[model samples]
Target: MSGAAALSRPRWSRLLLAGLLVLGLTACASTKGPGSPGQKLDPWESWNRKVFNFNESVDEAVLKPVATAYSEVVPSPVRQGVDNFFGNVGDAWSAVNLFLQGRFKIGVQQTMRFAVNSTLGFAGVLDIASEAGLERHSEDLGKTFGRWGTGTGAYVVWPFFGPSSVRDSFALPFDRLASPALVLEGGNSKAAIIALQTINARANFLRAGEMLDGIALDKYTFIRDAYLTKRRSFEDDDEEDDYEVLTPETPANPQADR
Candidate 1:
């Protein structure tokens, strides 16, 4: 394959997957069973599960192995620097979203951290902001919409993008526009950078995902529940805080703690 073709394949594949899932969801909803939980909230669960399976297959075939190799071969310092660079870029956009959500104080802190890290930290290859006691913050347009009282419309499994909701899916375009990958001029370069960032992020979460294996009989439900809980908790919109995910036990705490 040509370089451009190879670079574009995964991006197009994700878009295609999303279109297929959306079409399938419409069909699946009509044939729904009677006694489902939060039917309106997750009416597309059957379709979502199929999309989730495809995403998992893609991860196993490509992303996960690449991420594993990246973690093993790349030096810790280099990986950390790459992570910091991308994180600093994200914080810049997050600051704007935070401000839009009417969080002036945290907005200022996020902006300042980005500034300090970008300049003093060698374009964010070093995290000088953290050393200076300026904490990191994460904000996205999804949270901005939530703050404005938009309900998370339906749970969606976005192919390679994994889990999201209708509200978050709507916010994705704005999020993409703010990404550092968009700053790169060359298409190939942008693709490579995005792939690198994805792998690095996945590598960081490898341990947490591995921990889920022995704890849950249904990994799909476990992941979906965990994801929803985290999303709801972010904006303090969690109507219920009692939900828990199973975790491996330590000798110090034999019983699971909720």
Candidate 2:
């Protein structure tokens, strides 16, 4: 009976966690601002803002602290490789989009580019994109929707997930459910995957985070704006993502979206 109960326990726990993650993400999304007062908030954007804040709080309280500690313990190169591996995986999405758009040459090239480069080329150390004179682009579901002319619904801060816009907020549930991060079975397997993902995420942003440390007056605002910009850049035009509305220091007009 005890052994049976133990087996059931994990399945139950996984279900509970999955439910909680969805509920939490929904609750977070419902709380975003409408951009400002007097401007009526888009219903969707308002929700996104809430989620975005929730995500940030969770990151600060849990993930960021844990990641910082892990970084201190783990050597940087290992962490970098882990990051490269994940990035390469996400790059597959971009390659697909490019292919669907009839840019088969670019898509096929990127598939081989990210795979061979990240694996055999020492995790993108050789910078194959630069060598081949091709741009290295990021693609994800959120960005794909944006390419279809979707407006960024609202700014949302999710717990532990970081800043997200309205459109991207909607994409989170699907992404999380389909995520490789959740596939581990055994206790040790789960632990190993979590550690690797967390460390890789942190390591991937180590340089950007460090750069922000030097430039930001308010870390929260800085991260929020930077993330929003970067996410949009991934989907839409480069200019849309590059313009920063930081107070006391505004960026110059970005080139028109392509």
> TM-score, each model?
0.76, 0.59
- lDDT (tens digit, per residue) of candidate 1 on 100-159: 878788888889999999999999999999999988778798777656555455677897
lDDT for 219 (candidate 1): 79
TM-score of 1: 0.76
Candidate 1: regions farther than 4 A off: 1-40, 235-258
Each candidate's lDDT (Cα)? 0.73, 0.57
- Alpha-carbon deviation at 153 in model 2, angstroms: 1.1
Per-candidate clashes, comma-separated? 0, 23
Tens digit of per-residue lDDT, candidate 2, span 1-258: 799997998798556544544543454445544443111212344555566567667666776777877788888676655665666655666787656445566677678777776666575544555466545665565655455444454455565666665567766775554334565668787777666676667755666767876988866555555565565454232332432222112223435333
Report the CA-based lDDT of candidate 1 relative to the real structure. 0.73
- The candidate scoring highest on TM-score is 1
